[model samples]
Target: MVIYIILFGYLGLSLLLSRLNIRSKIEDSAQYYLTNRSLKGITLFFTLVATNFSAFFFIGFAGESYRVGYIYYTMMAFGTSFAAISFYLIGSPAWRLSKDKGYITPAEMLGDQMNSTALTRLTALLMIIFMVPFVAIQIIGAGLIVSGLTQGAIPYIWGSALLMVFILVYIWRSGMYSVARLDVTNGILLMTLIILAFVFVSRSLGGISEINEQLMEQSAALFSPQGSNSTYSPSLWLSYMVLWLTCLPMFPQIFLRFLMAKKESNFRYTSFLYTIVPPLLFIFPVALGVMGHLSFPDLQGKAADQIIPRLLTMHLPGGFGAVILTGALAAFVSTTDSTLLALSSLIARDLYKPIFKPQLDEKGTLTVGRISILILCLISLVIAFFQPASIFQIAAMTFSGLSIFFPVFLAVLRFNYRKPISAILAMILGEVVLILFATIFSGACDTLNILPVVPGVLATILILWLGHFFEKNKD
Candidate 1:
């Protein structure tokens, strides 16, 4: 009963905070999508953190660590830390360009830089394709947590639907302003719960040394760099590292956040905080997985993803369990709402208004964006209800697909490759390679054992070079 009250209270508080922003008149799509480019300091920092640390971190990362071992941590820590450098390299310049030209979405920036309507639509299409599955992953994670915590009192499908509805309501109300405000609350709760869960679980298990000793005895491979089970090879690990490092900055959700900064100086502070915080935040979840392995070594399949929630239910008292569960829910809502808002902005700004109703004013555009949010949420809910795959696998495929845009973004930011043909062909070639490697021929050719991002990235570069060659020859 107390847990239920806490959960309801948390939801009520979030909705009230989001509603407070709805009273602020939105003068244009800029205010709706970018929050009028007014985010700064702590608000900017926490939103970025909250947006990045999704269910993928809490559920997927922890589960993978449990399944494979410590190698997952090493790869994630390095990949996430390296991603911070993007704030300087990619984010700062993007911020300056957006501030100068009033860019709203990443596609808008690319379209302006390359002067191609087709390229803008294509960019938005790819983001929707990749981001929807990413959103579905969060929904799945939330469902698992709710079901697990309640001991199946709420079924997975209902849990997922409930969470999605909650997210859709607030996000549909105020757009990015609501997302940033909620993100600040979620970020603080996430950090606090993670530390508390780690300390309490560690104590219950007789400390870290005992946990390590048990793991070594149960499976010495857990301590090995590649994991106790050889789940990730040297090649696979390298590919994962590269995939995360490049893809994190390019993700539409994160990309839009870069443009939301109030000033260039915000990026400097964001960079410093981003570098130090994620690695620390990741430590406890990875440790929780290690602890879960000791406690429940025989669990298999999707069961591993439930390790954290299960541990909380068994060890913590009712009130503490509710707090941690709410924190995990915060992580889910933070990511889901941001992705939904980004998707809506993409559809409304890039595709719907441009292609269908060019004369739509700011009010009409905001209406389209809100309606798109509802539609996208329903689509994602359907996907989540089916529960196609584990959170990590779904997220990995999504990241690989999104990574295809890295080179195109590079061309926009660093290089002078401004041809529409080049950008379009590069994206197409990258997507083809990603589909072939990540889907069509993934498991059949196990002897090669390369991650999809490895070839997807290379294919993008090759196509860009080929495009450049053709352009030069034409001249």
Candidate 2:
């Protein structure tokens, strides 16, 4: 009952805050989709952090840390900071282009820059394809946390359903305004809880020194760069570093958040926060995983994702545990809401209106956006219900899937590759290679053992270079 009260109370407060912030009726699709392009410094900072961290960082990162040891941290934690560099490189220019031309979706910016309707449609389609899996992973993480906390009284599917319903409600109501406003609250709560979890978990399992001593004695291999179980090779580490850096800034949801800033200067604030805060925030999860291994050494497979929730529920007092559990819920909601909103914006503004109804008015577009949110949420919920894999595995696959776009985005922004065929062919060939490698030849081939993104990205660049040469020869 206390858990329910705290969980519902947090939900109620978030909805109330969203309602209070939405003073004016949404006049157009812009207001609903991008909050009328009016996000300021702190709100932008929090939303970016909230969206980027997600359940992947809280649940997936901890799980991976538990499975592989400190090597996961070396790859992901440090690699994540490189996102600040990506923001400086790609985000700034994209924001300028969006502000100048009233671009709402990534497809719009790329389509206009490339002068190709095909590229626009393909960009939107690829985003939806890769993003749904990520959304599914967030929903799965939420379900696991709730089920673990309730000791399976809630069940995973029910928890996922409940979460999807809540996300659909607030997002369908006010769109990006609600998402951004709620993100601020979620960001603060989650950061506080993570810090507390680190301290509390550390204390619960003796001090940091004692935990270190235990790890050294029990799993000395964890201290090595390759991890206790030799889970990561040198090539795998480099691949993960590239994946983490490119994936965060290139993923459509996060890339679009860069456009949400009220001004270019807002990114400066976001950049500083991204660089300084994430390293501090990641410390807790790495520590949690290391200590969790000591506490629950027998846990294996999907069960690893529940380490944080299990620790909070079993070790902490009732009130504190409930609050921390709410924080976990906040992480899921923050990422899922942002992803649904972004995907809906792409579907409604980019795909539906352009192809089906070129004359879609603002009200019609907003309605379509709302409906798309429901449809996408249901799709993701169904996927989460099946419980495909661990959060880390699903997230990594999604990142690799989306990394196919990185080379194209870079070409559009920096390389000035203006040929639409180059972008289109690159996307087609890149996706085909990724699908083939991931499905047909993943286990059979030793070369792909590093990571899928490495080959996926290489395939994309190869196609782009070939297309560029052919186009140049024709000219």
Candidate 3:
């Protein structure tokens, strides 16, 4: 009863907050999608952090840490901090271009810059394809957290769909406006709970020193740079570093943040916060996952994703655990809402408006976008049902999937590359290479010790460069 009350209460607060923020009548794409470009300073900072760190951050990071050990921290925390600087590098120019051109979606910006309608459509399609898996990762995380906490009372599908549908209600009402506003509240709650859980979990386990001593006696290889199983090889380490840095900012939701910024300084402030704050907060979950080895050493694979919930429910006090559980729910809600909005906006603007219904007015686009949200929710829920892999593995796969397109974005945005074929080929072939390696060439990837995304991203860059070279010669 306590858990149900807290869950419904949190969802109710989110719905109320969205109602308060949403315009009674959304009249234009500008108002509905980008929030009139008003996001700056603290609101923008919170939304960016909230969207970037999801159930994936809390559950996946902890689960990966439990599986491999401390190396997950260096890969995720420090590496992601380094990636945050791209906000200024990539965002500033995109903001300037969008400001001048009234660009709303990423495909719109790329298409205008490349002068290719084909590129615009393909970009939208590819991003949607790659992003659905990411959205599913959020659902998967939510399912694991909820079903684990309830011990099968709710079941994973119901647990996943419950939050997925609840999130859609707010986002469909006000679009990014509501999503961004909700992000502020969830971001604060998530950080506070993470810090509290870290401090409380360490204390409950008898302190950081005691936890460290136990690990030293039980499995000290966990402290090594290579981790317990040497899972993070030098090549693999390099792969993840590239994956987080290159692929992270290119996430359509994060990319949308660049479009939503009010000024260059907003990017700077948010970037700095991302660099410093997330890495620190991550210490909480990663450390919790590490210490979990002492008590829950038998937990393995996808079961490990339950470490945070397990620790809180069984080992910690009930009230504090409920508070922390709310934080987990907040993480799922915040991220899935943003992801759905981004995917819907891209489909509405880039795909539906241009290709299928060139006559789409703001009202019509709004309807299509709302409909897309429902469809995506259903699709993500279906994917969540399969439980194909661990949350960490699925998250990594999606990260790499998106990373394959990062170079194309850089080529168009940063390098003034004008060949649409190059961008299109990069998108198609990068994904093709990624698929081949992950599927038929799976064993080869293992033998190579480098992940498929490395070659995939490299393929994208190579094609873009060659296109630039040939075009330069032709000109």
Candidate 4:
């Protein structure tokens, strides 16, 4: 009962805070869709942290670590570090141009830089499609967090619905401002909870070295990047790294933060800080999972996914469990809010405005954005109720499409390609081919071995070349 109260009370307070922020800045603009270009250094730093630390970091990363062992941490941390480095390399250049031209979306950025509307819309549409699954996953994750903390008293549907309501209320009010503000607050709480949980769990499990010894004994390949079980092999691990590097940096949610930065310098600053913060923030969840391996060696039933929650419920005493639950909820909500906001902005500004209602003023755009957010949240809630896939699977599927998008844009960025039609055709072909590949060879991914992203990127290049060839002949 007390846990339920804490959950509901936290939701109410977060909603109230969101509304206050929204009303306070009711005059905020379409320009503010990526943030108003007025953010200070600290605010931008938190936004980057908040954007990257999605529900996946908690549930997926730790779960992967728990199942695979410490070596997986190196892979995750390596992927994350590579992403940060890419931001510095490619993203800094993009940010400078965005400042010069006042760009709001990556679609706009790509379109403007490459001079291709078709390419812009294609990227925007792909972003929206991929992000739907991503946002839905986060919503589902929030529901899971609520359900777990409440001991299954609350069904996943109602828990998800409650989160959806809180998110809609908050986002409908402040737009990106509310998101940025809340992200900072949520990041701090997340850090605190991580430290607290580590302390509590470590004490419960004896200590880090003892935990390490048990981890090695229970799974011989605990420190082996070769993978503990046969499920992940050397080639497969390399493919996983390739897939993550290709897809994650281009994630619309992450890119949206780069777009929101105050300036090019801000992008660099925030990106640097985001690099350090995530690995540290990530270690706690990893610790929880590793500790789980040590303490409850024979535990089953979603053990990896439930590491933090199980630890809290069994190891941490008193009110701290509720507090940790709130932090996990904050993690879910932060990811969901940013994702839903980015998706809605894409729909309203990039999809609807350019196509149907090009005459909308800032106020009109704001109205459309808020309405789109409401509609998107409602649709996602319906999907969550069905529970079609696990949260991790949903995230993986979302990125599978986006992995194709990244390479196409990289090609454009490298070549300075002016043909929008070619770019669009390439993106579509890449996505379709990748989907076909995944569907056809789904069984072979394990035995024969091929990372999904490689084929999509190759297909993108082939299509672009074909499109260019045809266009030249037509000319």
Whole-structure CA lDDT of model 1? 0.83
> For residues 366-468, what per-residue lDDT tens digits would candidate 3 score against the true structure?
8998999999999888888876765446555677888887888787777777788777888889888987888789898899888888888888888887786
The residue-by-residue lDDT of candidate 1 on 191-242, one tens digit each, is: 8988898899889889999889887898887788878667778877788777
> Residue by residue across 201-251, what tens digits does model 2's lDDT show?
889888989998988899887677898767788877788777776677777
lDDT comparison, 1 vs 2, better candidate: 1
Q: Candidate 4 lDDT, tens digit per residue, 1-475?
A: 7887788888877766655634355654544466566665887887777677777776666676677666676667766766776676456666666678877677777876776666677788888877887787788888888887887898888889988887777677667878887887787777787788888888777888787787777776656755556446667667766677777667776777766766677778777777787566667777677667765566554666777777777888646787777887878888788888777777777778888888987788778888888888887887777767654464566777887777666755555556677777788888887777677866666465776666777888788777666764211
| Candidate 1 C-alpha error for residue 298, in Å | 1.0
- The per-prediction tally of clashing pairs is 2, 0, 0, 0
After superposition, candidate 1 runs with Cα above 4 Å error: 20-23, 388-396, 443-445, 472-475
Full-model lDDT for every candidate: 0.83, 0.81, 0.82, 0.73
What TM-score against the true fold does each predicted structure earn?
0.94, 0.94, 0.94, 0.91
* lDDT at residue 241 of model 3 (Cα atoms): 81
Point out the higher-scoring one by TM-score: 1 or 4.
1
Please identify model 4 stretches exceeding 4 Å from their true place.
12-31, 299-303, 389-395, 465-475
